[model samples]
Target: MLTIQFLCPLPNGLHARPAWELKEQCSQWQSEVTFINHRQNAKADAKSSLALIGTG
Candidate 1:
């Protein structure tokens, strides 16, 4: 597994549009992807926009 950590660049943080876009992009990959919000102690499946949004 590959792990990447970066700060969110959005002024409002991860919202619906970006989360949906992210989910779309991740769908092209066969590997499982995860999004983690260290500050919030939240984890989300990258293929699910709702899960990504909840990570905020």
Candidate 2:
């Protein structure tokens, strides 16, 4: 499994467009991936757009 933390300084945080793009990229990889937001205590599947948005 591989995990990464991406800190976004953008005012919008991780919105639809960015989340979709990230999900698309993650989908192409073979490894298992997850994103966890320490501040929010939220978790997201790196390959899923809906899950990413739900994390926010």
Candidate 3:
């Protein structure tokens, strides 16, 4: 598994717009993509905007 770690630069964190954008981008990939929120102990499917926003 590949692991990537980065701080969110958005002032509002992973809100709807960014989450949707992320989902859109991830949808183009064939591999499974996931977003992990260490602080919240949350994991979300990168192809779903709702799941991404739920990470917060």
lDDT of 3 by residue, 1-56 (tens): 88778788765569988899989999999999989887788999999999999888
User: Candidate 1 — which pairs collide?
Assistant: none
User: lDDT per residue, candidate 2, 27-53, as tens digits?
Assistant: 998887887766688887889988888
Q: TM-score of the candidate numbered 2?
A: 0.81
Q: Going through the candidates in order, what is the number of backbone clashes in each?
A: 0, 0, 0
lDDT of 3 at 47: 100
lDDT of 1 at 26: 92
> Looking at candidate 3, what is the lDDT of residue 56?
85
Clashing residue pairs for model 3: none
TM-score of each: 0.86, 0.81, 0.86
lDDT of 1: 0.88
Tens-digit lDDT string for candidate 1 (1-56): 78778788875558999999999999999999999887788999999999999877
For model 1, give the RMSD to the true fold: 1.3
**lDDT-superior candidate, 1 or 2:** 1
